[model samples]
Target: MFRRAFWFTAGAAAGVWATTKVNRQLKKLTPESLAAQAADKAIEAGHRLKDFALDVKSGMSQREDELNDALGLHQDPDLPANVTALPGPRRLRAIEQDQNDPTTQFSYNRNEDH
Candidate 1:
């Protein structure tokens, strides 16, 4: 009789524990809970991305300063912004089309029969 009572008590406690565990798991799988978890993860990723961008910007600034020092391109108060000579589009040199000009001897005429 004592063994039967002990077994019954044990079975009731196990049932309660299993129900609580399943309920907690189900609550976590609900849509609102899932959305909240996803939002938390996205916020964490955004923070990491912002930190990475700041690090890249700092490194680029340092490299730019080093390159300027190496190339002796110190900014001068007396120099005009246009005088910095930053690379830009340039006009192509005009090709001489005259057949008689020796410099134009290699000019190809697509219409001429070989």
Candidate 2:
């Protein structure tokens, strides 16, 4: 029984050691693939930067052409139009005003009824 137990323990230890060794070997093969992937990413980034620069150049030229046209380097759209405003109190004068008509003040407070 003791011998059997010893063999089982030894087998488990060997398994553990072998697994660690295989993992280490696999790790050793990773750097070349990682370097290749990094190179691909760098190339992709370079192309994106080139496209962005071209888009910026195109936008700047369009704006410049529009400005030149507006400045009469080419034909412009319009210059001026007519405008008007509403007349208010500033255009008129306020005169004296009144409350109850003094002409019929005594006719208040009473009437011809019962």
Candidate 3:
């Protein structure tokens, strides 16, 4: 009788253990759990990508500074020695006027081609 009782207790314990293990696995495999896991991974990847972009930007700035120092471009704060001045607003307005003039030799009209 004692042996039978012992066997019964063992079987009940095994059944409970199996049921608990299966329930835990099922919970993990649910749609909500899967979506949450995917969301977490995507957020992690986004953070890593943002960090990489910031690092690249910092490296670019450092390299640009080093190049400026090597080329003696940092001597003037108002105007760099290596860079040329761009066309001002007056030059841009003159160029626009030229482009708009139909009598000009090099005038370009978008409507003319069509």
lDDT of 3 by residue, 34-97 (tens): 9999999999999999999999999998998898778775543433345333445664565578
Worst 10 residues of 3 by lDDT: 105-114
Top-scoring candidate (TM-score): 1
Query: lDDT of each prediction vs. the true structure?
Result: 0.70, 0.61, 0.75
Q: Rank the candidates by TM-score, best first.
A: 1, 3, 2
Count of steric clashes across candidates, in order? 0, 0, 0
lDDT tens per residue, model 2, 1-114:
999999999999999999999998887579897788789999999999999999999999899778876765643232112211222342211111113343432211112221
Superposed Cα deviation of residue 103, candidate 2 (Å): 99
Give per-model CA RMSD: 13.1, 24.1, 9.4
Better of 1 and 3 by TM-score: 1
